[model samples]
Target: MSIEIKMPALSPTMEEGTLAKWLVKEGDTVKAGDLMAEIETDKATMEFEAVDEGVIAKIVVAEGTDGVKVGTVIAVLAGEGEDAGSVSAPKAESPKAEAPKAEAAPAPVAAPAPAPAAAPKADGDRIKASPLARRIAAEKGVDLSGVRGSGPNGRIVKADVADAKPGAAPAPKAAEAPAATAASAPAAAPALVWYDESIPHEVEKLSNIRKTIARRLTEAKQTIPHIYLTVDIQLDALLKLRGQLNKSLEARGVKLSVNDMLIKALAVALTQVPKCNVTFAGDQLVKYSRADISVAVSTPTGLITPIIRDAANIGLASISTQMKALADRAKEGKLQPHEYQGGTASISNMGMFGIKQFDAVINPPQAMILAVGAGEKRPYIVDDALGVATVMSATGSFDHRAVDGADGAELMKVFKALVESPMGLLA
Candidate 1:
């Protein structure tokens, strides 16, 4: 028997990926855990590993193929004692392929038999459900028994569990009938408007990463109610501290950037104002116990946020080292899913680019993002007298649904105090 090797889902949100490269070719012997291919997901390019030892019988999908869906067979492996040459690759059917004539009705008879074979088990055994479906049911407190299976062989799937109501009686078959009919009905296609080719322009296809970024940012702006709060903080104290820290750390080969200090300041502020470190769950507010800040990095493909896990607990030297590495890998598209996934809040600094002040879109599941601008000399009122001060404008974009205006203001106050004091971040 031959084992089919399918494209693996590298991230939870990954539905399709580019088959970037293949490390193994047909007739190549591979052991379990061996690297077989490089798959480029929306966030990063990850190495795919083999699970079973076998000889590569055939490569069904070639490298550089884009939009290869998850769970699609990419290759076939011949098991031990099986001849690699004898193993046949599955044929990829196209709409242009010739279809079977009416005389081939006998072939359809066997297909109907498999459908019945997948029917619900007898003897009142446990329901047949996908792992994802079971996990969703457990999380949603939905009873599996009450949920109807719409998958092949009457198996419960993720969609079925998602639509199932917890504690409520299963929908009557008559009620489900209309839904099934609606689902089966073909949706009308919208009219297509062709672009004018006479105009001089370039048509560049969007990469998977770019497309994902566009969709996610669009959703964030549309769904998350944004509340923007801006504060002007004196950066002289932070600058002096950074200079001294960098001098002392230079012996250790660690140079701290101003952004590193901002990261620490944001983390400390989150701890001081814990209420601001929260996310909006449908019916509940999820408050994080620790401050993990995602720092935005720009790559050739698009923007990515790589997290600094427990930024508050880590020292300035450690933050500098880790952030440098994370940013480097993020730009190279080598970051793992975990490195760029979850965070209590985020920091997107455009200070380096001389952006004075700008509001950033809130990354979903994260309630807030701090946008940092460049520090420049400005007239300040000190002791009721006008004076010069190096100040920077910091804007906090909070999800109005999760954080109150007072809490957001308090978070900003704490952040400004930490930066102005310059010693609390070290403490």
Candidate 2:
């Protein structure tokens, strides 16, 4: 009584998925609710759980299988003691004795079944793990196919490492720690080695996420006609407001930042300039009733934009809290696709990094993006006097198809006024 296990539709737009890994193997028992596999879709990687208790009868789709059509029978589940390996595994045609080891590890490195090559080869080095396992291993930076499995049918369960003691496995004989470091540490500069001058390094292909970013950016640039708007904002008043607020809250736990103030100001301006808080949805213009602003945070992987829903209605304290939480989540790679998507507007501030000026690519759907730079003091004609004023440069990139020059400039003007006036944000 074997039951077919097909890939579930994880998202509305998902038509295919890369089987990331199989949690269970032939003859391995599984219980309902147990996480059985990981699937990488176009947007995000998600876990698949068991729906029924049974032994894995067979895995039809091996890990690293790309373009696996939805609803395909990837595996089979059978009642206890049922022969699970009765179904023949799909065999792929080989070119070399084994396929060339350097063949790109597919667009997705994660799949639910074992890869065609039992040895997971990365950079021509043999790796042993399901595509799903390889993805997890790659993410965790663990050398897979290198570690022995302790699960039924010799499958590597995620918990095996959790229960293992350190220094238990045999050290690798194929590679050794740098001889110079293992023997005696080298001085400040080591004698020039022949390898240092002409060593050739192989560059691996970009991961799916990186490829998607490159593709999206290229599309945005080529498809959208971009117009840049630059404006200088006086920040002395805003800094003064922050200092006063912090002074009043010395006993309180909140310390304020200029970026937080900028967020608040931007939110206010978006609310005033409703046109800027809209996306260029083809066939019809889509204007949002609320300002859901995505703030770009730089992570080790790349730039991730986390949304602050209804940012116009939130206070500066709340904005700070949300930004901190999103930044932490972005660094951990725990944010979901929705958490990093669907914003009517976006903001990228490099002021803290001391960047004087920069232009940002408009995150699609959203018609405009604002880039903020470091604040500096400069001579200005204020009222009737020539005096020193702290000014910051902000640039806006707008989709010409969606936002006109007046529409874009109006948003910047509002932002400049609110930031310079400072009290307008509190109002």
Worst 10 residues of 1 by lDDT: 183-192
User: Model 1, 1-427: lDDT tens per residue?
Assistant: 8999998999998998888789999999999999999898887778899999999999876676666789878899999999999998765442113223322332444353332222222112436665556655655557677778775346576668776776642443673444323322221111122676579986454667887889999999999999999999999989999999999989999999999999999999999899999999999999999999999999988899999999999999999999999999888778999999999999999988989999999988899999999998999976689999999999999999999999999999999999999898898
Q: What is candidate 2's TM-score against the reference?
A: 0.66
What RMSD, rounded to one decimal, does every model reach?
Answer: 12.9, 12.0
Q: Each model's TM-score?
A: 0.74, 0.66
* Model 2 lDDT on a 0 to 1 scale: 0.71
Poorly placed runs, candidate 1 (over 4 Å): 27-34, 51-55, 79-83, 91-196, 382-384
Best by lDDT: 1
Task: Compute the lDDT of residue 403 as modeled in candidate 1.
Answer: 95
